[model samples]
Target: MRPLQAKIIADLHVQPVIDPESEIRRSVDFLKHYLQHNPQYRSYVIAISGGQDSTLAGKLAKIAITELNAHHTLNYQLIAVRQPYGEQIDAVDATAALDFIQPDQTVTTNIKSSTDAMTLALRDSGLIVNDLSRGSIKPKMRMIAQYAVAREYDGIVIGTDHAAEAFAGFFTKYGDGGTDINPLWRLNKRQGRDMLRTLEAPKTLYEKIPTADLEDDHPQLPDEMALGVSYDYIDDYLEGKNVPNKASEKIEQLYLTSAHKRHEPVTIYDTWFY
Candidate 1:
């Protein structure tokens, strides 16, 4: 009851049909406008994971910085951060994304050492930490690494959260979900790929299956399989297309269960009655 599912599509500003080129221009223009208003910002820091969301975010950020430099003679920078736990299974795709983004700066910070140290400290304190719990830490660590880079550069951390993911509350709270601004907040996953194709993005990066891969035991698992529902269905629902009752129910259930992720931390003054 916290979030009326009926109002979600409108709340997220999801347009069922969109012109990729127009959306791309709009997002880029929004980024430029944001920087113009906030003159103190220096760079746009993005985590390039070779996935559709990050790849698109990075591409748009690079374009923003590049255009600012070309037109306004600004010294803006685009910092692309690569945070892999140990060895990324799809390093090739990540490389390809970086090749496409060609960010002004690329920072590779392997979070393995820090991830392991936290695990050890917890275990030493006589607490039992499961693999799934440890796996969840990777995203938080990656976020930490990104923020560290942003803090050092006085940059704004760009987030990849879009309507579909935000509607389902699919991101880890304060982890992959934490960011300064969301340029892709109104687009869905399919719309994101459409923009990518319009931008002539590498076919491999957009075509590659998206995975959180938080389960160390099961590496490179597709997001649809892990979520128990397909992106097509989520997109359909977000687009206001009629979907099966079962799929709709599952989507709503996911949204309800993960509702806390969508809000700030609860406080004593919070009102829960609905």
Candidate 2:
């Protein structure tokens, strides 16, 4: 059984050429609206990695701040942060994104020690400790940094994880996968790319290979290699089409199996409804 099957309820097939401008607009609007309506959070903290997904998310957040400032004249500010583990392009991307947005606050932290701590904690757990899980240690460390920054700044962590990653279970639980707000939750990679293009994000970000920079000089994992199928094929199967190839079949099964992660925990009701 694959993880993807249980997570997806319906497949909405959208062509690449389809106009996603409206979708982008709606997503941005929703995030802004949520911020305005929710009084608990004072600011928004964006984890800027300079990848297309995070870059796009950061741009949209900037636009939201601009919109709110224009109408309400609030004192809210966006905070751009980078948590560098091993040496890689992540910090470069984070710095570039910070320059682009000129966040009201910026901070960088060396989280290698924290990464080690997380790896040890995971080892104590009973789950099988594989390379992928070990690789997730850095992300867990970054999540701790983000949460600390969020508390200090009276804000919440914003994320760029989209449907594709969620469907594939590519993120670490309570790590990079956890966020106070996710503006890209509904959008998949293709839609995310479209939004990035629409927002005129940096070309380098779009062109750069996707790497999380967990390990020093860590190589980026391709979607196919990581998930046993390509994102394009997963996207197709998730959209309800009968996936023909063997790769697609395995991907579909994995997606279905991982569906439980996307939803709230299931619990037995103490009392039946009348």
Using TM-score as the measure, which candidate wins?
A: 1
Q: Each candidate's lDDT (Cα)? A: 0.87, 0.70
Residue 185 CA displacement from its true place in model 2, Å: 1.7
Query: Which candidate number has the best lDDT?
Result: 1
User: Residues 1-274, candidate 1, lDDT per residue (tens digit)?
Assistant: 1144457777789998999999999999988889888988889999988899999989998898889989786699999999888998898889999999999999999999998998899999998878878877888898999999999998999999998788778888888999988899889889999999999999998988899877788888898887788899889888888888788888888876776777888888877523
lDDT of 1 at 158: 94
Please give, for residues 81-190, the per-residue lDDT of candidate 2 as tens digits.
Answer: 87666565456676677777678788887787776666677678866656666676667777888898999988878987777777666777777878888887766666
TM-score of model 2 relative to the true fold? 0.83
Instruction: Give me the overall lDDT of model 1.
Output: 0.87
User: Where does model 1 exceed 4 Å of error?
Assistant: 1-5
* Model 1 steric clash pairs: none
Model 1, clash count? 0
User: Model 2 scores what on Cα lDDT?
Assistant: 0.70
Stretches of model 2 off by over 4 angstroms after superposition? 1-18, 118-131, 215-218, 239-243, 269-274
